[model samples]
Target: MNIVVVGGGLAGAHAVQELREQGYPGDITLLGEERHLPYERPPLSKGLLLGTEEVQSIFVHDQEWYADQQVDLRVGTSVTALDLDRGRVHVGDHPIAYDRLLLATGAEPRRLPILDALEVPVLCLRTLDDATALKSHLAGRVLIVGAGWIGLEVAAAARRAGADVTVLDTAALPLLAVLGVELAALFADLHREHGVDLRLETSVVEADGSTVTLSDGTRLNPDVVVAGIGATPRDTLAARAGLATGNGVLVDARLRTLDPHVYAAGDVANHDHPTLGRLRVEHWDNAIEQGKHAARAMLGDDQPYDRLPYFFTDQYDLGMEYVGHVGPDGYDEVVVRGDRERRILTAFWVRNDRVVAGMHLNDWDAMDSIRQVVGSPRSQAQETTARP
Candidate 1:
């Protein structure tokens, strides 16, 4: 069988590797829009931005490895169209036929609409090129829009690089969606303690050249501006190809799309999560694991992808980890393992006396225990006592 995997991010790279390792002797073609080989993205904001990690070290596999695996790598080529009925993908002037296809397009960074209006140079941290540019332009004051994980990470990197850093967010507390109010407040304080100028409940009305005007009419001159709001999945290609699309390319428990021959995985897939029901994860671990599972399913394995989703972020000395799913609403109680002031906190969202979701900050032990509890069906009391 011939397999074609599009978008050479972590998911695409992992899928191709898994397929070859599983003894798939068929022709495998990995198409990537980026000129660089597949590389890890998690380091873009943390290590690379801070100059602790080299760009060449990010690739999970080297060029020699791909050749050894007998996988054809097509770099710097964009898949413009998908001919579902014809079983072919169009890349510029070339069209490649495939017996099966994997969509691992990943996600693109979200940009502010008025990004051009900001007279000062602005940067994003989605790609290696973006990180390189931002790193080189860190000699002056930097202002970041949004206090999410990426924004905070960039802020940390800039501060370490001796640049005056400021972060602004419209929400009353940054990280509200992930950590909730109580924990988010603690994170806000963490930034302030590190000498970061953080403005909460503040909206950017206009940005021009060297100044950003806030809704409160406060103007600040900055040399660089960064918008790390978040990302949206690249689902248009799959949707246009007539596959089910909702939030992301919809898939079943087996990671198979409506069309059995086509599969979607990684950040671009909205699969039926085992414990959480249906959800889409943008986590780095989820992308690698899910991509491997999808490749297994393509090899005719009856196994269903049901791994517990996990994600972690590094900000200064803090290591934040999150596991499981907690809806925006519906939580009866919150269990805190350590006080926020101590700089070690783990909060569990308890519903119906069961730990539904959790977040950890510097609480490594709690993070390990929570990961196990989230995977198993157990009451909060039992899980709490089981933890040492």
Candidate 2:
């Protein structure tokens, strides 16, 4: 059976790797738009930006590993069109036939219209190239628009580099939608204490070269500008092929799309989770797990994929690991253990008196305990007593 995977990111690479590991001795082809091999993106903003992590360490596998695995890895190739009816994907009129296909197209950064309209080059953090370019722009004064995870991480990295950092966000606090007011306040304080000029409920109204005007009549000339707003799933190929598409390509519990011959994983798959319903995750853990699940599904596995959403971040002295799902207003109350002032604590998001999600800030050994409480279908009162 000939299998074709589109995407060179973590998910696509892992999916193909899983296929070979599972002892699938059929033809396998992996195509990626980028010239580089499949690489992890988290280091791009953290150690890579800070000049601590080497560029070679970011790749998932060495260049020779692909050849050793007998995988036809094609880099710098774009899948221009998907012909689902013919089971072929066209690369600029060159068609490759496949018996089964996986679309791990990942996502692209959401462009900032103000910067685009002003014809100002604003750096974004999504790929390796972006991070390499941003490292050079991390000096002098850096103005960041958006206080999401990416934006805040960039701010932390810039401040550590001794750059005069100013962060503007329309939300009241960073990660307001993910963490409620109480937890969000912690991040706000963290950045402020690090000497970041964080401006909440503010936005860039106008810009003339390096001088930018804010909504509150504040004008400042910054040496560099960065847009770390968010990203949109790259599902245009699936949508054009008449596959079900929403925020991402709609897939069932097994990562199988409506067409039995095709599947999707990673950031591009909006999975119909058994317990959580339809949702799409853009985290590194999700990409790794979902890619393996998709590979098994393509190999005729019947089990469902229902792993909880997990993500982590490292900003200066603060390191965090969060598991499960809870929107800003999704939880009724947040239960805390340990001291928040000392930055060593584990917080649980309770909904209907049950622990739905949990997170730890600077608490290294709390993940196992957080996972136990979050994975169990127990009451919050009972879970609270079971501390790490």
Candidate 3:
């Protein structure tokens, strides 16, 4: 059987690795739109942008590894059309037949229309080229629109590079979507402490030349403006091919699409998580796990992908690892323990007397203990005893 995988990101690379490790005797074709091999994106916003990480270290697999494994790695090529009836994917004029197809197409950064009229380079951090271009202009006055993960990380990196950084957000604090108000406030304090000019509940209204007009009529002349609002799943290709899609390509717990011959993983797949119900995660760990899960599922493994959601982030002196699944407004109670002033703390979101999610800040050792009580009691009484 010949297997074809779309995208060349971490998910696609991991999926192929899983297939080969499972001893599948199929001919694997990994098609990438870029010339570079599959690379981890987390480093793009963090280490890569900061000039601390080398470009060669970011790749998922070396080019020599692909050639040695006898995997057909097609770079700088894209699948224009896919015909499910004929089990064929068209790369421009060329058609490739596949017995099994995996859509690991990742998401793209949401772009703003205001950048088009601006003379100064408006940046977005998503790809390798984006990080490279952003780093070059880091010495200037950087105005960041959207105080989300990527935006905040960029601010930290730019500040480290001696750039005057100003962050604007529509929300009250950074990471408000995923973190609680208290934790979000902590992050806001973190940035403020680090000399970031953070303007909360603010947005860009107009951009003319080097000056960007804010909603509050505050005009600022910044050399570089970055739009790091968020990312939107690259599900258009799958949706155009008539696959079921919502926030992402809808898939079952086993990572199987509606069509038995097809599957999706990574950021593009809206998985029906066992605990979280239908959700699409855009983090690195989810991509790696789901990619392998989908690969195994394609090989007739009956195991379901039910691993707990987890992700990590790094900014300035703060490092965090969080686990579990809780919507923005889902939790009923929040309990924070340890020295919040020292930055060694753990915050637990409790719902129905059970811990739905927990975050460990600075104290990485608390992760294991935090996991034990995630699905169990997380009340003030329990939190009093289980303070990590």
On lDDT, the leading prediction is 2
* Model 3, span 1-388: residue lDDT tens: 8999999999999999999899997799999998889999999989998888999999999988888777899988889998998999899889999999999999998988977789999889888988899989998799999998888899999989989999999997888878868789988999999999999998888988777899888999999889998899999999999999999999998998898999999999999888778889989999999989888998899888998889998999889999998964488877888778878888888888888888888887788888887887865325533234
The clash count of every prediction, one per candidate, is: 3, 0, 0
Worst 10 residues of 2 by lDDT: 379-388
RMSD of 1: 2.0
Model 2 residue 64 distance off true place after TM-score fit, in angstroms: 0.7
Q: Across residues 123-180, which tens digit of lDDT does each residue of candidate 2 receive?
A: 8899999999999889898999999989989999999999999999999998988988
Each model's Cα RMSD: 2.0, 1.6, 1.6
Q: Model 3 compared with the native: what TM-score? A: 0.97
- Candidate 3 stretches greater than 4 Å from native: 379-388
Q: What overall lDDT goes with each candidate model?
A: 0.85, 0.90, 0.88
TM-score of each: 0.95, 0.97, 0.97
Candidate 2 positional error at 328, Å:
8.3
